[model samples]
Structure formats: C-alpha cells, structure tokens
Target: MERRRSSSCKMSLCKSASSSLGYVDSSMDVDCGSGWKYAPQVVLVKIYSFLNDTDRAIMARVCRNWSLAFEAGCLWRRRRFEMGGYRARTAEFQASGFAEKFGQHLRYLTISCNHPSLVTCKIFQRAMEAFLPKLQRRAKLKEFRFSRLEMDRYWRYEQLKEKLILTLTRFLRQQFCLRVLDLSYSQFYLSAGLRIIESVGLSCGHCLRRLIMEDIFHSRLTVYSGLRYKRAISRFTNLRTISLNYGYLSDDVMEILRGNLAGKLKTMRVRVYRSDPHGHRITKLAWNGLRRACPSLKVKFNFESIGFASDIIPILVAGIPLYELYIWTGFDDNSDWRLSSILNHVAVNFKDTLEICNFEFDNSTEMIDDALFRLTQSCVRLRSFITNAVLLISTIQNICELVEQRKLDPRTFHITACNLSDLEWAELAYLQEKYANMADERSIDFRLSSDLIVESRHAEF
Candidate 1:
C-alpha cells in the first residue's frame, strides 16, 4: 500500500510538469488543459496576427486566455473604421471600447466616410469628436488618412461640416510624428481646408514625408486664402511629396514651394478637373524655378474632365520634368481643342524627360504627322505612348526606329492609337512579320490596346 501511494504521487507530479510545459493535445480539451491554452504569449500573438480585428474579436470570445492575446499591442497596429458603408460597411462605426483599449497600439488608422446618410453622418461626427482625441495622447500614428466619396452635395451641411472639420483640425494639431496624410477624393470648405493645412504645417512639420490633398477644393472663396495657404505650407519643414488640385496650385503657391520645398520636394501630383473651370495657374517661370531648385523633381499631371463643363485649356507646362501626362476623356465629349500645337510643345519641352504620355482624346481630335514624327524622333526616353489620336503608317515606321536604333527598350515600348488603311494594314503586317522573324529574345513586342485598333485606316491618318 505504501509503494502504490508513492507511485500515484509520482504520476501526479509528472502530470503537473507536463501541464505546466504545455505539452497536452491542442486538438481538444482533455482531462488536462489543452496545449493552446498554455501556449506562449509570443506564439499566441502570432496566431492572432493572422486574424483581422473582427476575426480576432470572435477568437477572443473563445476563452479568457485568447482575449489576453487579442489585447497584445502588436496585433492591433493597423486599424480602419468606417462611417457609412465602405463605399456609401454599415450606417456608421458605433462608439465602442475598441478605440480606448487599443488606441495606443495604432500605427496606421484610415477612417473613410464616403456617401454617408444624414443620420449616420451626425452619429459619426459626434463619435469622431470623442474618439480621435483619445488617440492623440497615446497613438503616434505613422499615417492617418480620411477621405469622403460624396460630391458637392455635402456643401449644404455647413454647420455639421464645420464641426467635423474642427474635430479633425484639433486632432492634427496634437499629432507629433505623422508621416503621410491623404485627404483626396473629397471636398472641404475653404476655411476648413485652410485650418487643416495650417495645422499640418505647424504641427506635423517635423516628420511628415508626404501630404496629398488632391481634389480637395472650394479655394475660390477668398482671394487672401491663397496667402493663408502659402503661410501654412511654408511652415512644413520636411514635406517631401505633395498633391493638389488645380484650384490649390497657383503661381504664388508654387513660388512659395520653390523657396521652401526646393531640394527637399520630390514629387508633385497635380490633377485638373474640367468641372472646376479654374485652369492650372502655375506658369512656366515658377515651374522652371522649382525644377532648378530640385533637379531630381518629377511631376505627374493628369487632366480629368466630366464633360459637363466647358473644355479647359491644355494645362501642360514646358521645361518641367513631367514623368507622366494623362489626358483622360470623360462622358459626352465635343471639345474645341487642338492637339497638334500641344504635341509640338511636348516634343520640344519634354524631350529628355518625357517617359509615359497617354493622350486619351476623343475621336474628333486630330494629330499632325510632323508632330508625331518629332515626338518619336526627339523624345528618346519616351517608353509608353498610348493615345487615341489618329496615326498613319509613316508614323508607325518612325516608332519602329526607336527600337531599331536601340534608343528604347523593345520589350517596354507600348504604343497604341493605330488607325490605318487597307494598304497600310499590309505594310504594318509586313513590319510585324519582319520583327516576328527576329530572335525571341531580341524581338520587338509592341503592346497595343485592342480597342484602339481600327481596320479602316487612311494613307494620311
């Protein structure tokens, strides 16, 4: 009896040691606790990482131990809460303990309020007033993005909009090390936008790398508003990349940017919406000065029109290192604009720097053969030249020379906008056949859009 009792105590000790070491089966709970229940903190956090915030919450409900793992800061680094649906998810993200609990761990927070109902907008506005302040004390977000998909319809909500803007501005004022802030695809009142810009320049100047406020507008509210923006942006000590709408980018603003951003600025993405009617106001002198200051600067300028407004002037500037130029056509189009002059200007101005030029004009637009020839001849760095503008077989021959002279990489040169006649079709076929005969590695592969290929071609297309 004494020997049996001693063996039983020995077995109990062994069982306790196994349980403490977390070696029990993880598949199901046994007489002893499961291995997962005793899993290491780091191991449990790794498992929680695989689950999103919603999934992690569900996992936490399984047991108290999993809930502890869910609270791990590393698992809550990036979070996104929506107001309204994702495009219009639910009506709004309700106020909850989630922000208060994991606010300290948030590194990147994106809050999108796109197409919200009146009721949801009110709820979200109030919730944000209480919510974003909590983050300022503890969460030093690396990037914070807030965007709305609503159009000019929300301009009527003046009182509510002002409150929300104030809330966001207050949040920005307290930010310390924010890196990127994107407020594109949205509209803010003139005063509200200026306040936010001022806050960013004054508060986030130390560590901000990129500031994008594209399509954010209502700038024509006051003339002195330009000076306000200039003062605000000049204070941004370390801003690298900035994006602005046509209304925001003016000669005065660019001049200020030329002095302040100079060598520090890298990219400026500008968009011109036709509906805005206000043309891009940056002149050649200002752009050239900026170029001189920042030799490594690149500009990605896009022209977008909704076709409802009148045709806008060709907004491309000469002597600027325009890396990419896209002129997109919107819905119903009949523009009284000419492309020949613009092409000539581009051929001469952007010869050394032009890389991708997508001139997507409507079918009514015409292009001169000399303009095409000069563009292909001068801009040797031009890699992707996709346009809906008409072209002939002679221009096609000029494009082939880009690959033949080894001036361009044959594998990368993508050319569309081919409109040819029956005779020209035979010639193009001959050219394609000739290139096809070359070695597989050294062959000319011109990637063209199928939609732009039309059978009816003229000798003088």
Candidate 2:
C-alpha cells in the first residue's frame, strides 16, 4: 500500500511538471491551465497570430494574459468592418476597450455601410463620431476606405449627406499620413465634396498618392459645380493618380489639373456618361495644355459616345507620350475608318513606351484588322494587348514570331477574336514549346477566343 501511494505521488508530480510546459496529459485529458502564461509573450503572440479578429476576441476571455496579448495591437493591423451586421460585436469591441487599444496599430481600415434599412445615415454618423476619435491616435494610416453601397437610387437627404461629409472631413484632417484615399461611388453634395477634397489637400497632400473621387457629382449640381470641384482637386499637388467620373471634363477642369498637378500626376482616368448633354466636351487646347503640363501621363477615357474620339485621339497622338491607353467606346458603321486610323496612329506613336493597350469598340469588324496588324508589327515592346479585333492567321504567326524573337512571355498577350485552325493551333503549340525550352520558363498561354474565326488568305507584310 505504501509503495503504491509513493508511485501515485511520483506520477502526479510528473503530470504537474508537463502541464507547466504546455503539454497535455493524455491519460487525464487536461491542459496546462493557461501554460501560455509561462511562455514568452512573443511566442504567445505567434500562437494567436493565426486567429482573426473575432477569434482573438473569444480568446481574450480565456485569461488576463491572453486579454493583454489580444489588446497588444499586433493582430489589428488590418481591420474591415461592416456597419449594419456587426453592431453587437462592435458594441462589445468598444466595451472591451479594444477600439482604443487596437486603433493605434491599425494600418488599413475599410468601413462599409451597404444595407440601407439596417444602417441609416444617423447610425453611421454616430458610429464614426465614436470610432474616429480612437483611430485619430494612430500616427500613420496607409489606406482609409469608406463606402456606401446602394443600387438604383442614392440617399436623398442633403442634411444627412452633409453630416456624413463633415464626419469624413474630420477623419481626414486627423489622418495626416494617409497615402491612398478612395471616396469613389459615394454620393455627396457638391459643396461637401469640394470641402472634403480641400480638407484632404490641406492635411494629406504631402503623402497622398492615389485619390479617387469618382461618381461624387449630384444631379442637382450644375456644370459650374464641377468647375468648382476641379479647383478643389487642383489643391492636391502631390497626387500620383486621380480618377473622376460622371462629371464634366471641361476645359477648366483640365487647365486646373494641369496648373496644379503638373509633373506630379502620372495616371488620370475620366469617365462621363452621354446622357448628360451638360457634360463638357474636352477641347484640343485643354488636352494639349494638360499634355505639356504632364509630359508623361497614362490616360484612360471611358466615354459613352465616340463623337469626341475624333478630336481626343489626334490630340493624344500629338501631345505627351502615352504609357498606357484604354478606350471603351461605341461607334456607328461610318466610324469604322476613323477607328482604324486612330489605332494605327496610336500604334506608331506609343510603340516604344506603351505597355498596356485595351481597345473595346462596338461594330467595325474588318476595319480593325489592318490597324491591329500594323500595331503588332511596330509595337514590339508591347507587354499586354487586348482587343476585340479579329487577327489574320498571318498576323497571329507574326505575333508568335515577335514573342520568340523578343523573348516576351506569350501569356501577357491576349486576343479575344477567332479560334485558330488545327494546323495554325499546332504551329502555335510548337512555338510555345520551343520558347519554353529556349527560355527555361513555364509553358506559354496564348488566349484566343473560340467563337469568331473567319477564313482569310495568309498575307505577308
């Protein structure tokens, strides 16, 4: 009996020692009773690193050490929260003091309010009022995205919009170190939008690199309102990329952008709908002025009408070097010749510098072929080419030859017109295999649409 009792006591001691080291006792089915406490704080953090925000919150309740580690701000670097669905969790987050503790470590924050009935403007305003104060303590935030998702119609209350804009402006004023600010697709009153732009320029102009204020125009505002907005946008002197959509791209807008963002802006995308007759047409003078201001700018034009293309394309070809060009436009049957001419011009002008070219047009089938072929012949430095134009088999062969000679990866080239014949496909396969062997790289992927093949004799250039 004495021997048995002594042996049992020895086993108990062994179990206790193992438990202290975070080892589970298989026989007793027990844990270390918070053995993470005994480990290094960093090791504890590493263990919790795999857990997401909600999981970490649950883990915080396990013990005080875990709570401290959870609140240490390491795991809260990137946080995305939806306003409506997570009200309970958000309340708990605030109650637990996690907002104040974790806000200091936040680098990327995206808050979205989508469900209209569930998340009203008042609710969002109140939430921001409470949350932004805590986040203001963060010395530097990399990206701040606030989006309100609604389809078909916009929030109608001007008062609510003003309140939301005020909250956002306050938040922006605090984030002096922000780099990317995307307020795209958010409805704001024209005056409020201008104020926000001005505020961002005043506060974050130094570090702000990418600013997207697309689709902020209100229908009630006049074309003159866009001019005012442009003046405000001009204040962002250090912006690298700026995108504006659904607003008039008038002469004034271009002149303001040129005067303010000269030598600083790199990429500019402007999109306007054709339904608005009040939309200001971009003039050649305005285009040339902008080109002279920023000599190397990649431009994207998404226009509903092709009437401006005749003027726009010539100016682009004549003015600054285009690094990348994306045009999505509709054309009448008569416009085929014009489209072809514009494309050939682009090919010749931007051959050396062009890296990405995407052209999507309605109608004009065979007109694009010759121009596309010319483009391929001249633009040997092309990295990504996507077009809806049908390429001749001979053209495909030339492209493949270029890919081989230039040692360009075939995967970067995409053509969305016409499947190749078995013979042509086999030849393409041979070229890909040969290139793969020569370069010692992965197999090349040449994307060809299977739907629109046409029979044409092979012609040599």
Candidate 3:
C-alpha cells in the first residue's frame, strides 16, 4: 500500500511540471501587439518631440492615433516653411489646418523664399495674405525670421519687393510679444525698414531683446535717412543685442545708438564690406560716445578697410570693459608691435570681463607668445582664445601650466597658423593624452590647425 502511494505521488508531480511548461508556452505565444499605441498621450507626445520633420511624417503614417497626437503636440511649436514658386494645393492646405494649428501653438516661425524654383511675387503675396489672419492670432509668438535669400537678385523685381515689404510691415505691426526679430539677408526699402523698426519700438519695445538687420539697404537713401532711423531704433529701450551688418553702420547711426541705448545695449556687431575706405570709419566721436554711453558693451567690428584700429583700440583699452574682441585685419597694414600692444593692453585692462578673444591677422608674421601667456595668466574667466598667429610649443606649455595651476576651465583654445611644425603637434598630442589620463576635474582643450583647414581634437591636423 505504501509503494503504491509513492508511485501515485511521482505521477502527479510529472503532470504538474508539464502543465506549468504548457502555461509558459501559451503566455509566450500571446501577441502583446505594439506597446507604443497603448501609451499615454503625454508619453507619446514626448517621444514625438525628438523626431525630425521626415521622421515625424513617417511616424504619423504608423497609425491613426499617432497622427492625431503628433498634430496636437508641442512638436509643431516651431515651424519652418520653404516657400518655392508652387502654391500648396487648396484641399491639402485646408485639410492640414496649418493656420489654425500654428496660431494656437506656434512660438517660432521661419519663412524662406530663397529656393531655386523662384516663387513669384504675386504667389508669395497671396500666400502671406492667406496666412496673415492666422499669424494675427499668435499671441504666444516670440521669434519671427523672414529670409528673402539672395535679395540682390530678388529685389530687382519691383512687385516682389513691394509685396514682401508690405507683408513684412503688416506682420511686424502685430507681433507685440516678439522678443527676437531677424531681418537678415532681406532687402527692403528705407521707408519699410523704418516702419518695421517703428512698429517694434512702439509695440514690442519692452520685450524685444535681439534685433538683427544685416544687409539692409535703401536704394538711393542718404546718411540723413539712417540718422532718422537711428532715432526710431533708440526707442527700443530693452534691446540687449543688435547686429547691423553689410553696408548698414554709418557714423551717424553709431552716434545715435550711443546716445539712445546707453546702459541697455550689451552687444553690438558691425560688419561692412565696401571697398571704399570712407564708408568704414566709425569716427573718434562715435567711439567716444559709445564708450561713455555703454561702458560695458561687447563690440565686434569687422571691416575690409584698415586705419580704424588706431582710433578704436585706445577707447577699447581705456574705458569699455569688452567681453568679446574680434579683429579681422583684411590688409597687411598693422605692424607686429601694434598688434602685440593691443593684445597686451587687452590682457591687462579687460582681464576681468574678456571671455572671447579672436584675432585673424592678414599674415602670420607676428609671434604672440608673450601676449597670449599674459592673457592666459590674467584672464581667469577667459573661456575661448582664438588666434591665427603662430605659437611656440614652449608658449603653449606655459599656458597649460598656468591654467592647471589656477584651475581655469577654458572651453576652446585654438591656434591657426601655417608654421606649426611636427614636433609641436606631437607635444600637443602628448599634452592632450596626459590631460585625459589625469583625474583632475577641469575642462581643457588644445587645438592646432593649419591656415588651409580648421579641425579639432587630439592633435588632428
């Protein structure tokens, strides 16, 4: 009777084991399906935010629910439209409901008409008209960037230019909450440019922080018109950064900015490309005015013409606490002594505030070892030091030693020259390897490149 009971228990144990295996097999065979389709809407939206335009389109086609969620999420907050000559189909536009969606959610909008297909003036005008009502409802809009790429050719068409100006003026008048307005590379009549400036000054003056008006031109306007527009720009009291590039900065404009912006302006970038020497002078009065008005202004002045350094450098060294200094000498007119003196003066005077120092000399005749060493030693806050001058290996060693001793954290240290030898490159590589191995908690980057190519990394030539 006991033997029979033991055999019966063994049989029952085998049956239980087989039933457990069968249960596991059946559970594995059950298809769970796509888990993403069942995810919460917020989780789906967060995932969709990482996708690019093409990827988002592909994801939308994955299923119906994903398409709806993608259309309603934060992924559509920033929209870029490439305006070619062709108009979007009416049915497609209506179905997409672009205006309704964008008006409710768009914070940034970029409209580009610089394609090869060449959108006609009338088509662009009609498109702007169709989108205007939607744009008017963008209460949360903060940035508006309009590019009429290669305006030199596009502006030749009178109808296109006029329509663009009208549309832009209308757009500007309504953007009361805009913080950034970039009209770079877009040609507009002097009147239209002034009107846009006036609209921003009156409507969004309290909120506007950055205004870029690069490559703006007025067909036959004189310096008087620029002076008038300067007064309009002055009304933008909260502007922190302003860039007037490519044929915009005249003496009168600079003077007006000095008197108007005063302590409010933080950065001013002026780039002029005229071959005539007279057009590039930012006179002593203007320089002195800027120095007095905005004592802590960061100035980036780039000109193809020479001879303004003598007038500008002393003022920069004297009063203004420059944060960034970029001097691109287009001509080989400055002496090595003059360049060294400028660097030394900056290292001594602006040491507390200077963060970026970029110098592109016409040639590599100057050896800036001493000036650079002094700068690295003095400027504890210097984050980026870039130069096109040839540097000695010993100088680089000194800089590294100073930085290590002071525990300085510089983001970028780059030297561009044609004279860096193989020995110097090897030394840089050794230093980089040593720094990488060191357990020191500091970020130090050393880069050496030739004049023909600009590359970075552990002694990557």
What lDDT score goes with residue 142 in model 1? Answer: 89
Rank candidates, TM-score, best first.
Answer: 1, 2, 3
Candidate 3: the clashing residue pairs are none
The numbered model that scores best in TM-score is 1
Clashing pairs in 1: 85-89, 86-89, 420-457, 421-457
What's the TM-score of every candidate structure?
A: 0.77, 0.71, 0.70
User: For candidate 3, what is the lDDT?
Assistant: 0.62
**By the TM-score metric, which is better: model 1 or model 3?**
1
State residue 458's C-alpha deviation in candidate 3, in Å: 11
Clashes of 3: 0
TM-score of 3: 0.70
Candidate 1 C-alpha lDDT tens digits along 22-122: 32222333322587767788888998788654455445544556656766788768877666644222323322344556678888988887656776667
Please provide, for model 3 over 232-314, each residue's C-alpha lDDT reduced to its tens digit, 9 standing for 90 to 100: 86677777888876345556776767766788788887654434223344455666687678876787655433424463454
Distance (Å) between predicted and true CA of 29, model 3? 25
Highest-lDDT candidate: 1
